[model samples]
Target: MTDKSETAQPSGLPYAMSAYLIWGFVPVYFKLLSHVSPVAVVAQRVLWSIPLLLVIMAFRKQLGEYAAIFRHKAHLRNLLASATLVAINWLIYIWAVSTDHILAASLGYYLNPLVNVLLGRLFLGERLRPLQMVAVAVAAIGVAILIGDALDTLWVSISLALSFGLYGLIRKITPVGSVPGLATETTLLAPLALGAVLYFAQVGGGGFGDDVTTSGLLILAGAVTAIPLLMFATAARRMSYTSLGFVQYTAPSIAFLLGVFVYGEPLSTTKLACFILIWASIAIFCADAIKSYRASKA
Candidate 1:
């Protein structure tokens, strides 16, 4: 596993883009399993991801490194916290997409980078640039607009943003390798996930073993969950955080399009206005990041 602090050059661009692109399209994948209860779907995802992650760890010959993490109690505790956060994030996202709240899901991810910046300023003592601060303010206004419009689903967006933002922060501070860390998280969640699955099965609500297609899709959730994250971890280690942050928009943008076109979600004037504000804020934030990157290089 590479050190998180080690920075590679521009070579990670493709990896980062691929990861976000997959993430952007993931709504379609989840939609296929919309017949299942969102909670059960999440449980399946958690349960399935463990073996897939273990395989990756074994193939990479990083299994030893992963086992070593258990020896450190602090790392386990931090991972436990991160795992809980990610589970919440995942549950909300799955529920959003499954219930035709794709737009809210899209907005949540769109707001996530700004939330990340805010978390950095508040918790890490990192000072935000003027443009970045403006970006945060602008995003807040967009969110406020949604709230003002009585879009009760705004909680979905805010919760997703905050949970994922905090999860990233935890991952940043933890010295564990991404694959191993995620594997550990999944391992911790596995018991609960299994219990959920078993309970659902007992109640005849389990999607597994009902049909081949649903079963396969549920199983494939593991790959879908792990692969993009692994790609993201790779890109994060190899690229500057600014560049990664900029690329993060790809996923949400794709989701936005999917909501509008594919899912036929209604886009009211208020939603459009909010999206415009968010886009403008992102442009400003990216411009500042690019300027800073160039200055640092010089």
Candidate 2:
């Protein structure tokens, strides 16, 4: 039997688009929870996601398979690391949005694919194409441009990029289905999440029960967080990696617009220059991906 994910199917287009769009607009949802502590928000996300994902696994009758993956101690170990990385990514992203560093967050994501490319070369022994090398260097300069003007929040961008990039690397090497892997990660983090709830409540910062709207939104964080991830995994199954890569920019682009235009975050000339450089890098990188994909097909 062959892996379905290795083949391209037109139907995957909708799933890919839907996933990226939701991810793009997700800042809006997190922004709504601005009053909540980032820790509390992430805790709610992890706890709520457990139940929903378990239900999804059960509905798909993957419960047994999910359980079997854990029997491998190696898988368990890698998943623990992946879980930690994802949790870190979630916290930084929320903090960035609430503190008006959405542009930094946006830039982090804009640089993510490039980060992945570099990681692939570094860890997976993949060779970087000429354009890809240029893309990476260009993105680095874009990041370098921010060291002076945006030094204060530059950590947010780099942390987000590195953490998520590493998380993807771990997941790519770990042989498991996306949903199962995610369910396991949440399970591992459940204890930490519960501690966050208890600690926050003790300090009177847990915002879940503060009001009806807040509580409801916290509960729904599961949906907002898990759905797009699941959709993306599904889409990845039916699309070529290169094709999927082409659409990966949608989320950051949307978030960038929301940061500047919708939420009125100021964009400085220096930051604008960085974005332009990153965009140019993406163009070059994407052109390379297109050519490589076509060559493989030929």
Number of backbone-clashing residue pairs for each candidate, in the order shown: 0, 0
Q: In lDDT terms, how accurate is model 2?
A: 0.84
On the 0 to 100 scale, the lDDT of residue 230 in model 1 is 67
lDDT of 2 by residue, 1-298 (tens): 1123424454677887898899889899889889899999999999999999999888867777679777989989998998999899999999999888899999988888787777778887778889889988999998999998999988998898889778867766776776887888898999999999999989976798899999999999999878886676566556544455567799899999999999999999999999999999999988998899799999
Residues 1-298 of candidate 1: C-alpha lDDT, one tens digit per residue: 3433234343678878999999999999999988898889889988889999888788877788789888889898998999999899999999999999999999998998898787777876768899898888998888889987747889999999899888877777777777998888888899999999999999976799999999999999999988887677667656545456678899999999999999999998898989999999999999999888899999
Clashing pairs in 2: none
RMSD of each: 2.1, 2.5
lDDT of each: 0.85, 0.84
For this target, which candidate reaches the highest lDDT against the unseen true structure? Answer: 1
- Write down the TM-score of every candidate: 0.94, 0.92
